[model samples]
Target: MRHARDFAVTVLVLGLLGVVAGVLWSLLAPRPPYVMTGEGPFLADPSTQALIADDGWFAVVTGAIGLACGAVGYSLSRRGRPLAVVLGLAAGGLLASYLATLVGGAVNLAPASITASGKAVSVFPGPLALTAHGVMYAWPTLAVGLFFALEGIAGYRDSPLRTPFGGQDPYGPLSSYDISDR
Candidate 1:
């Protein structure tokens, strides 16, 4: 019961934090307007290529959700280090997420547009964007979001219920309710 409660509260808090972080991050660099002619400053090069590709609102929302998940996991598993769990694996996780996004973003099968060309360029049907986005951006971001949320959960571990099997939650016996009854 306690662990369950912890998980729920932790998840909620982490979810909020992730949403906030994601929103703020997006605000810092909101999607620039799509220029009709050439590329802008955010794009990769001056070759009329739009700088930051529009990932859509879905990315922002889903990214926040994923971050919340990671935060929840971190909250459940951390040791003495409060911020350590989230902050600890953050860099590595971010890198993994980015790499995954790159791989997923690959449009090898169905060719994409280079610039303002509305013509369809089809090669294969192996779109990797969503795949890469999931690993590269989703998981790590959620992990960081969970870190913030778990901080609150950690504070509520006041009673520190001890189980017969020396486990946090009881799969066999000595859960929060049973232990109290005993």
Candidate 2:
């Protein structure tokens, strides 16, 4: 029951953090410049760097948020079941990633303008978009990876194989060694 509660809380917190990540991505990601002509919008520059940069920004922001979520979830679930906590992290990460994309895209809607007799009229920045859709997985991947890495470290520290001598303790008793042996 406690584990279930903790899992629910973790998921909820991560989902909320996704909204923040979306806002941050929208604010930080750069939009490609486009010329609004009579025909349609066209890229001002031939280079696709701006489009790629937008995806990069989204990945960076979401990845960072995911890492934070993993750390927080691990800390909160110390007394809970690892499996349940991991599932929560995975499910929450997916929700957060999806929400981030939706919120960021909504926040970055194309600007409205009336182009009369438009012939290479005004130059407006395009909306934020992910050129590489795979970037969306950044959140969940990082979240789960971080959680496992932390769990492994903690497990290793508490394992009986580890000893104060920096090696395996075959004797099974620390007191068995004479104090003068040091």
Candidate 3:
């Protein structure tokens, strides 16, 4: 029951983390500047392929999110197994990435036009015509890898052998340096 509770809390925290990451990605993502012609109602379609092709900004965003997820997983699963955290991160990351992509999809190559007087047109809000490639899965993969790496590092640090020599010193330094004396 405790384990189940822990898992739920971890997922909730990671999900919130994903939301923050997604918002940041959307805000930081760059788009090609374009102006619509006043010929007729324009349907501005900005695909993710073009957005990622220029600089792979999506990949960068996913990688950063994965690293953060891994760190959080490590912190949460200190008393348990890292696998649990990894799984939570994977699920949370996928959901978060999808939502983030949708938010970012709102920004199209050409701004929407509702009204125009001369050369300037008033833009309208609409759905973003963006698509997701394998970039969306990058977060979970990287996050799992990072969690294991951190777990291994933490294990190594705790693996150092300690032998008692004398007195109350756990590492057996010297009688004069014994902690029991103090």
Best by TM-score: 2
For residues 45-155, write the lDDT of model 1, one tens digit per residue. 334212233244435544655565565556556544444445434644554444434433332322234433675432222222331234335555666766666666665
Q: Order the numbered candidates by TM-score, best leading.
A: 2, 3, 1
Best by lDDT: 2
Q: Which 10 consecutive positions of candidate 3 have the poorest summed lDDT?
A: 122-131
Q: After superposition, how far is residue 106 of candidate 1 from its true place, in Å?
A: 2.5
Task: State residue 167's C-alpha deviation in candidate 3, in Å.
Answer: 23
lDDT measured at residue 68 in model 3 versus the true structure, 0 to 100? 79
Q: For candidate 2, lDDT tens digit of each residue in 1-182?
A: 97787678778888898889988999999878787667898997878698889899999999998998888777866875777788888988888888888888778655645454654257677877788999888988898899999999999989876775566565877777798878
What are the lDDT scores of the predictions, listed in order? Answer: 0.44, 0.83, 0.64
Clash pairs for candidate 2: none
Residue 14, candidate 3: Cα error in Å is 2.4
Extract clashing residue pairs from model 3.
105-128, 165-172
Off by over 4 Å in 1: 1-54, 57-65, 81-83, 111-142, 156-182
> What's the distance in Å from true for residue 54, model 2?
0.8
Q: Pairing residues by index, what is the TM-score of model 3?
A: 0.62
Candidate 3 Cα deviation (angstroms), residue 8:
2.1
